[model samples]
Target: MNLALLHDSDFIDHDRVRLTGRRFAHLAGILKVELGDQIPVGQVNGDIGVGRLERLDNDSAELRVTLDTPPPAPLALSLVLAMPRPKMFRRVLQTVSALGVKDIWVINAYKVEKSFWQTPWLADEALSENLSLGLEQARDTLMPQVHLRKRFKPFVEDELPALLQARPGIVAHPGTSTPCPSHINRPATLCIGPEGGFTAYEVDKLVAAGCQAVHLGSRILRVETAVPVLIGRLYDSCAN
Candidate 1:
């Protein structure tokens, strides 16, 4: 973990926090920190700063926290993705969070297996777990919001129109003639399809809703890989 993420409950006082469980282990076992070591820390959905280790024991540790810096700026983009396979979903969640994407829409598509929705990783606790890992990895504190849409037509015809007002939607399709726009550096809604990709009919519906389909190149990429590539391409903040 790049940052020790402290939840609100971890705070014993305004400037002190009690660490236990994974965080405590990270301090006691991994870092092997002592009484005076200062570590990078952040409050969830709050601020990024440092925590000075004060007390250490097998059960827990206490740190003096002083938060003065804000978290990284969030990407001005909304990711609308067809729900990925369960294994890929967890990685995708982390990747999205690490990239500073604050909005996520997981929609249904023709090729998406019904069983994919049954994964426990989509549960509240699991969602928070992966998102936390992502945030800590990036040393970012702002959490991304995940929206689940089980149906395609309703989401496209009803909800998508309203979302389009914020920015023009860009749909990633493998065979699209137009190359994906690079360094867009503006608010945008990105629509990614399923493993086998959205059917032609679904693509048309997204287009009708004001999304322009674009392509990365001749090669196709897995959801986990494509997400970062696409985000890096679209946002200057991600470009190295």
Candidate 2:
């Protein structure tokens, strides 16, 4: 973990935090940090800073923290994704969060397996853990919000229009004539489909909901590969 992400529960007082579980193990075993050492730390949805280790033991560790630096700027992009395979879901979640995508919509698509939604990774606790991993990797503190929509048509017809009102939308399709625009550097909503791509009717619905259909050349990419590539194409950089 590049940054130790602090949750409210980690705090014993305004300035002190107690670390345990995976975090403690990492510090104790992997990092092998000594007492009095300062480590990078950030509070969830709060500021970035440092924590000076004041106490340590096999069971836990204590640190006095000071938060002042701001986290990296969040991407001005919203991701609307068709549910991906269970095996790839966790990685995708972490990838998006690390890339600073604050808004996410996981909607159903024709090619998406119904079984994909049954994955434990979609559970609230699992979601938080994966997102935290992403934040820790990016050294960011702001938590990204993941929205699940089981019904594709309803979401597109009802909710998506409103989301697109503020950030104009784009949909990534493999063979579309319009190539995905590069470095738009503005707030945008991007819709990506399932493994085999969205069926024509579903693409039509999304297009009707204000998403311009675009493509990433002739390459057919897996959902996991496509997500980061598309985001990189749309924005100047995640740190921006």
Candidate 3:
């Protein structure tokens, strides 16, 4: 973890926070930090700064914090994704969060297995934990929002249009004529289907809802592999 991300619950007072569980283990066992040593820290969705270790032991550690730095700039993008396989889903969540995608839609697609939704990784706590890990990896504090839409029709028809109003949308299809646009400065809502790609009918619905169908050249990428490449293609380098 590049930054020790503290939640509101971690604070004992305005300036002090107590770290425990995974965070404590990381500092005590891996980092081997000493009192008066300063470590990078940030309050979730708040500020980035440093925490000077005021007290420490095996059980827990306390630090006095001063937050002044701003969090990294968020991506000017939203993601509409098909739920991935259970094992890959966790990594995808972390990847997107680290890339600064603040808005996400986990939707159903024709090729997506029903069992994919049954994964424990989609549980509230698990989602939060993985997202936290991603934020820490990026040294960012702003939490990304994940929305689950099990029924594809209603979401693509009823809800997606509104989101597309602010951010013009696109869906990644393997054989589409249009190449996925590069370094798009405007905020966008991007859609990616399951491993086999979205069926013709599904693509039509998204198109009707304002998403342009596009492709990433000749390669057919797995959901996990495609995400970062698409994100990088769509946005400029993130500012530190």
- lDDT for each residue of candidate 2 in 1-240, tens digit (9 for 90 to 100): 999999999999999999999999999999999989999999999999999999998789999999999999999988999999987989999999999999999999889989888999999999999999999999999999999999999999999998899677999998889988888899999999999999999999999999999999987899999999999888888525
List candidate 1 stretches off by more than 4 Å: none
lDDT at 133, model 3: 93
Per-residue lDDT of candidate 3, residues 1-240 (tens digit): 999999999999999999999999999999999999999999999999999999997789999999999999888888999999988899999999999999999999989999999999999999999999999999999999999999999999999998899677989999989999988867999999988999999999999999999999998999999998888888886422
In the range 1-240, model 1's lDDT, one tens digit per residue, is: 999998989988999999998889988998999998999999999988999999998789999998999999998998999999998999999989999998999999999999999999999899998999899999999989999999999999999988889687999999989999998899999999999899999999999999999999999999889999999999889987
Clashing pairs in 1: none
* lDDT per model vs. reference: 0.93, 0.93, 0.93
Supply the TM-score for candidate 3. 0.97
Candidate 1 backbone clash number: 0
- Candidate 1's displacement at residue 189, Å, is 0.2
- Model 2 scores a C-alpha lDDT of 0.93
Better of 2 and 3 by TM-score: 2
Error of 1 at 171 (Å): 0.5
| Model 3 pairs in collision | none
